[model samples]
Target: MTETFITIFLVFMILAAVVALEARELLSTVIAVGAVGFMLSVIFLFLRAPDIAIVQIVVEILTLVILVRATISRDTHFFEDEREFFPFAINIVMIMVFLIFAFWAVKTLPRFGLNFSKVAPYYLTKGLAQTGAANIVTSVILDYRAYDTLGEATVLFTAVLGAVALLRRKAKAAENKNG
Candidate 1:
C-alpha cells in the first residue's frame, strides 16, 4: 500500500517537473515546482524519514512563497519560449531514457516493511554502545552518520544562500534602476 502511494507520488512529481519546465508563465512554473517539492516531502514521509520530510516541506513552502511573491511583483509574467525542433527532440529522448532508468531502479527496490540493509543490524545492535546515545535513531544520525548529516545540512545551507543571493541581486538591480 505504501509502496503504491510512493510510486504514484513519484510519477506525479515527474509530471510536475515536466510541467514546470514547459510552463511559459513564471507563476505557473513556480506552482509546478512547488507541487514537485510537496510531492517529494510526502514521499520522504512515506519512506519513514519524518525529520527529513519536515525539513523538505518547510523549505518547499518557503521557496514557493518567495518565488510566488517575486513572480507576482514582476511586471512581465509570461516569457516567450523558443521552440527549436532539434533541442526539443533531444530533450524528449533524454526524458524517455530517464523514465526507462527510473522504472528499472524502482523495480530493483526492496519490498517495504523489511529490514534490507546489512549495516542496519549493526547499527541497531551497537548504536548505543558506540555513540553513548540512548536513542538508537539519534546515535545513528549524529554519531554513525555524522558525515551524511553534515552533507545534508550543507546542501540545505547552499540552497538558502542561493535563494538569498537571488533576492539580494534583484533588490540591488531595483535600487540601481531607481537611482
Candidate 2:
C-alpha cells in the first residue's frame, strides 16, 4: 500500500512538472507549479517527514499567492511573434538534465540506521547539547548553517526590492505621462 501511494505521488509530481513547463498561460503555469509542490508535500508526508511536508505546503501557498498577484497586474500572455524557440528548448533541456541529476542523487542516498550515520538522527539526539535549541530543525537552520540561510534571505530580499523598484518606475512613468 505504501509503495502504491508513493508511486502515485511520483507520477503526479512528474505530470505537474511537465504541465507547468508546457503551460503557456502564466496563471496555469503557476497553478501547475503549486500542484507540484503540493504533490511533493504529500510524498514527504508519506515518508513520515511531517515537518518538511508542512514547510512545503506553506511555501507553496506563499509562492502561488505572489504569482497570482503578479499575474493579475501584469500581462499573462506572451507575444507569439516575439517568442524565441531556442531559449525555450534550451530551458526544457536544462530542466530535464537537472531532473535526471536529482533522481540520481536521491537513489544514491544512504538508508537510515541506528548508528547515526546521517545528520538528522544525530541532530535529534545531540543538537540540544550543541546548539541549546529544543527544535532540531531550528538548530540546524539558525545555528549550524545560519550563513546559508542568511545568504538565501538576502538574495530573496534583493530580488523583491529590484522587482518592486522596476514596477514602481514603470507606474510612475505612466502616471507622469497621463498627468
Candidate 3:
C-alpha cells in the first residue's frame, strides 16, 4: 500500500516537472514546480515522516508565494529556443542514465521492517533507559538523533526567516509609496 502511494506520487511529481520544463509562461512553470513540491510532501507523509512533510509543505508554500509574486511584478517572458539535435540527443541520454540509476538504487533499498543499520538494535534496546523516555520513537528522535533534529529545526527556522524578510520588504515598499 505504501509502495503504491509512493509510486503514484512519484509519477505525479514527474509529470509536474515535465510540465514545468515545457511551460511557456513563467507563472505556469512556477505553479508546476509548486505542484511537484507539494506532491513530494504528500509522499513524505506516506513514508511516515510527518516532520519532514510539515517542513516540505511550509517551504513549498513560501517558495510558491515568492515565485508567483516575482512573476507578477516583473516583465518575465519564457522564450523557448529551437532545440538543436545534438542537445536534444544529449538530454535523452542523460535521462536514460538517470532512469537506470534510479532503478538500481530502488533495487538496493532494504525491505520494509528490516533494519540495515548497525545502530538500530542498540537504539531499540537502550534508547528507553538512556533517554528515560516512555515512547521509543520520542527517545530515539530526541536523544539519539538530536543533531539531525537540530539540523531540521534550523532549516525550518531559516525558511521562516526568509519569508519574514520578504514580507517586511514588501511592507516597507508600501510604506515608502504612501510616505
Q: Which candidate leads in lDDT?
A: 3
Model 3 C-alpha lDDT per residue in residues 16-95, reported as the tens digit of each score: 99999898988999999999999999988898878778989999999999999999999988867876899899999999
In candidate 2, list every pair of residues with a backbone clash: none
Better of 2 and 3 by lDDT: 3
Q: After superposition, how far is residue 130 of candidate 2 from its true place, in Å?
A: 3.2
Cα lDDT of model 1 by residue, 119-154, tens digit: 999988888788888778778878888899899899
**Residue pairs whose backbone atoms clash in candidate 3:** none
Runs with alpha carbons beyond 4 Å of true place in candidate 1: 96-114, 132-135, 151-179
What is the lDDT for 96 in model 1?
99
Q: What lDDT score belongs to each candidate, Candidate 1 first?
A: 0.89, 0.86, 0.89
- The residue-by-residue lDDT of candidate 2 on 11-119, one tens digit each, is 9889989898787788888899999999899988887778899999999999999998998789767524655899989988999999999998988776532354577
Clashes of each: 0, 0, 0
The deviation in Å at residue 82 for candidate 3 is 2.3
Q: On a 0 to 100 scale, what is the lDDT of residue 73 in model 3?
A: 97
Against the hidden reference, what TM-scores do the models get?
A: 0.71, 0.65, 0.70
